[model samples]
Each structure stands twice: as C-alpha cells, then as structure tokens.
Target: MRHHIVHAGWLTAALAVLGGVFALYVHPDFLVTLVDQIWSCF
Candidate 1:
C-alpha cells in the first residue's frame, strides 16, 4: 500500500512537471496561474 502511494505521488509530480512545461511552451503568460491552480489543489 505504501509503495503504491509513493508511486502515485511520483507519477503525479512527473505529470505536473510535464504539464508545466507544456503550459510554458503554449501559454507562457498563464503558467503562473496554471501552477497556482495546481497548488490550490494541494
């Protein structure tokens, strides 16, 4: 169970970083707001 949880956390972090990179490439201006929204989820 604990291993699964850690795996999920790492997966989520990786996806978030990918998302940030994509956002930066497509919409640099909104990256901050996009990240702010992501942080709000936490």
Candidate 2:
C-alpha cells in the first residue's frame, strides 16, 4: 500500500511538471484547438 501511494505521488508530480512545460512551450490556442477537435469527434 505504501509503495502504491509513493508511485501515485511520483506520477502526479511528473505529470504536473510535464503539463507546466507543455503550457509554457506551446501556445494555449493550439491546445484548446486540439481539445476541441477531439471533443467534437467524440
């Protein structure tokens, strides 16, 4: 159980960093457009 908790925490931290980097490097408009495209397809 402890191992699982640690793993989840690390994964969450890594994803947060990845999201920050993506937001900083990519344009917000592009991300919004991609999300819109995917959502419309669904």
Best by lDDT: 1
lDDT of 2 by residue, 4-37 (tens): 9999999999999999878856787877787899
Off by over 4 Å in 1: 28-42
- Worst lDDT run of 10 residues, candidate 2, spans 24-33
Model 2 segments beyond 4 Å from truth? 27-42
Residue-level lDDT for 23 in candidate 1 = 68
Structural similarity to truth (TM-score) of each candidate: 0.63, 0.60
Model 2 pairs whose backbones collide? none
lDDT by residue for model 1 over 1-42, one digit each (tens)? 999999999999999999888868897668778788999999
Total colliding residue pairs, candidate 2: 0
Model 1 RMSD in Å is 7.3
**Best by TM-score, which number?**
1
